[model samples]
Target: MNTDFLVIGASITGINVARELKQRFPDTTVVVIDKESGCARHSSGRNSGLLDAGFSWSPDTLKARFCKQGNQQLSDYCERNGIPLNRCGELVIARDGDELSDLDEIQRRAEGNGVKLEPVTARQAREIEPRARVHEQALFFPSSASVDPAAVMRQMEQDARDAGVRFYYETSFLRKAGDEFVTTLGTVQAGYVVNCAGLYADQIAQQFGFAGNYRLLPLKHNYLESSEVPGAFRTHVTAAADLSGSYPGTQIFLGVDGKARLGPAVKPALWREQYHGAEGFHPFEMSSVVTTGIGQMFQGGGEICRACLQRFTGSTHSRLITAGSRLVEGIRASDYRDWARPEIQPQLVNTETHRMVSDFIVEGDGKSMHLLNTVSPVFTCGLPLASHICDQVAAATGR
Candidate 1:
């Protein structure tokens, strides 16, 4: 097979990149290949599905800039394409005096990133989310929205196909030979290759001698469905404070569907896409999770330990609902047990340190660019990131 460009991975990043490339160079042929039989069978389909409101990262990071733009773009796309979305807003709840300080810092950072955040008192938190039971103040980001992740990927795939992008499913990229990618199906020749292979991105890039800079460490994020409360919660609830130790910032979000799910705890796993005790769990990953979790606890301290304990014990539907209520006042723990389930997030682990990348990393010298570690908010930044990638590719090819 021959094409002008080959996009490895048909997730949001790959499809978005392909679509953007075609839009810019209408005459160029673009081909997308994925190991899965269809689109979004992996991370793109199984995520919190929240369109972040741009407060997650520092203003200087690529994530912060692209996320701010992507959030707006995604909202607009959902509106145009009739994708289901809930602008239910988000609350970064500060539970104690210590968390209040972090909440303030988050607010300041949000302001710097051009995201609007309102510091509301506990009373005000209840006013906005009548079910909220905030112990300290909360930072409300009204612009944050949620979407059905599968729907978004489906729409993107449809759009890309409509734009004349070709997709090859159940085909894996085995390696690269000279200027062609050796795949399970056949060798594909291409002028440029873009690797947006999500969980396997680093491995794919390494096959082409491009991703020696880092190694991917996969972490299993577990989610619990609310057993009792089916439709009690409204807005997303996140930890208002920065937890001590290796816990980045313990936060949980309530989905728009009213089921409260917790987690994405940073449990390191050996496999690239391990989920604990779930359908995708790998037995070999148990030791890794234990070791990494202990290391994180040592570094982060009691806060992460508490959070981990909560997650382990709270895996039950009833416990999750209770935890959600305690964290977010008006939420009825019993009302959410019906809709909770486990969800795993893929983390880009540094090969040397075996630690996850906290920020986004984009690599390419112009002709070909690989989007490495576009973990969480990448979906929200799809538009801006696509534009940026397109601009770079165009400049490199001088097209």
Candidate 2:
């Protein structure tokens, strides 16, 4: 097979990249290949579906640069395409006086990022959501929303197809030879390649001589579905314990159908696709992850160690219920016994510096471009990020 542009993954990033390339160079042929049978067979379909308001990142990061714009663009797309969307809003609450500073910092970031966040008192927060438990004050973002990820994924796939993009499913890229790529189906030649593989991005990039000092540190995010009625909680309520957006401290998110779900107890995984027990297990990948985690624990001033401890302590059913109880006026542990579909975040860590890469990363040359670290908020930042990447492609190839 031959094409002008080839995209490695068919998820949101890869599909949008192919669409953007076709839009930029209308006469050129664009193709997308994925190991899965269809789009969103992985993380893109199994996420929490929260459209983040772009307040958790510093203004200097790429996440901050694209998130606000992406959120707006996605919301608009949903409205125009008849996709189900819930304008549920978000509440960032402080447990006590010590954490009030975190709310202020988030507000500062919101201001710098051109996002709207309002400060509300305890009484005012109750008016917004009767179940909320606030310390003294909280920040309310009316622009935060939710959508059905699977629905959005289906729509995006159709849109890409409508735009003259070809998709090759169940075809995995095996290796590269000279100027052609060896795939499970066969070899192919391309003018340019874009790597947006979620879990195995680093491994694929290494074949092209990129992502040398980075490796994916997969984290399992688990959620619990509340058995109560749909409108149990009016909006999303999250604890302000961590502001790095690395650990989504105890949160209750309302789905597009108005059902409330609590969770995302973040814990490190032993392997890349270790979503459940003994499922998708790879021994070699487990060994590599363990070795890298041990190195990070010792060299990064025990930051990873502390994070692991927190997650381990809070992941249990009883412990998770306790944490959730503090965020809302919840009553029983029996209401949240059912666990939702688990998702994994393929976060990147700097192997040399032994620190987590907090921002988005892109490493490429004239022949190919690799999107290495697209962690949380990438779903919300997908549209704008794709346009930005296509801009780089234009500059590199003079298209």
Candidate 3:
């Protein structure tokens, strides 16, 4: 197969890049390929679907800028395409005076970043979410929204097809054969290549001598959707901090389909694509919510997760443990039936620093662009990120 631009990985980033290229250079031929059978099976489909309020990072960071603009861009995309969106907003809750201080810092950061954060009193927070354990205060992000990422990617894929972008699924991009890529299905030659390959992006770019020392580490996360706990959540409520500051903070989501979900315990996985069984991927226990923070859920960490819940939030309603560090009330633990769709993200580890790389890493000049760490809420920043990456490719390759 031959095209002007070849995009690897069928995630939202790749899809957005393809479409953007087509829109900019309508005469240019764009071809996209993915290792998966379908577009959204991997991390793109398995996330909490919360568009970051554009408030989580420092104002100077790239994450803060893209996320702030990306949230609104995506909201507009959903509106134009009939994709479902709940602009119900989000709440960052504080458990006590200590956590409330964190909220104050977050508000300062948000104001600096030009992201709107409204402070609410304990009574106001309870009015917003009665079940939420609001202690001293809560910050409301009015621009935040709950989005179905899988739906967004699906729509992008369709729109790309309509615009003449070709998709080759189940296609593995092997080593480069001179100026072309040798794939399992066929040989692909293009003026430029963009690798949005989430998990193996660094490896692909390494072949072209980019992304100097980044290696992917699997961060496994799973959620338990209660069978009996009715979807009672109105707005998205999440914790203020991860405490350890290692992994992500717990955020509870009420799906457009009427299911409330908590968790996504973050831990390292031995293998990227390997799953032990339902117990590992789909644990269905009440106490399993807290199991992720202490250790692996498959081990005896369920009690630890439960213990953390009792210790921090002071509530065991199954709905509130991962929500934050506050003592929430009104919500009770119900019988949880099974695990929701679990996902593992490619957490880029700087081999030299031996730490998780939080920022989006882009390498390559005009010839190729490799997007490493395009995970999670990156979907929120897809449109602009795609535009920026494509512009780089355009400049580098003179396309």
lDDT of 1 by residue, 82-126 (tens): 988888888877777767777777888788889978888888988
In the range 1-399, model 2's lDDT, one tens digit per residue, is 999999999988999999989987999999999999999898787787889999888898889999999899999999999999999999989878888887788888889999998899999999998888899999899888999988999999999999999999999988889899999989999999999898888888998999999977888888889999998888999877656446667788899999988886677889998988998889999999988887786676776677677776788877888888888896478899899988888888887877777788888889999887778889999999899889888888877
- Candidate 2 weakest ten by summed lDDT: 240-249
TM-score of 3: 0.85
How far out, in Å, is residue 14 in model 2?
Answer: 0.5
Question: What is residue 23's positional error in candidate 1, in angstroms?
Answer: 1.1
Write model 3 residue lDDT over 171-252, tens digit each, in one string. Answer: 9999887898998888988988999887678778989989877655565666667563444666777767642243345666
The TM-score-based order of candidates, best leading, equals 2, 3, 1
Clashes per candidate (backbone, < 3 Å):
30, 0, 7
Worst 10 residues of 3 by lDDT: 284-293
- TM-score of each model, paired residue for residue: 0.85, 0.97, 0.85
Clash list (residue pairs), candidate 2:
none
How accurate locally, in lDDT, is each candidate?
A: 0.73, 0.87, 0.71
- lDDT, model 3: 0.71
TM-score, structure 1 vs. true: 0.85
Better of 1 and 3 by lDDT: 1
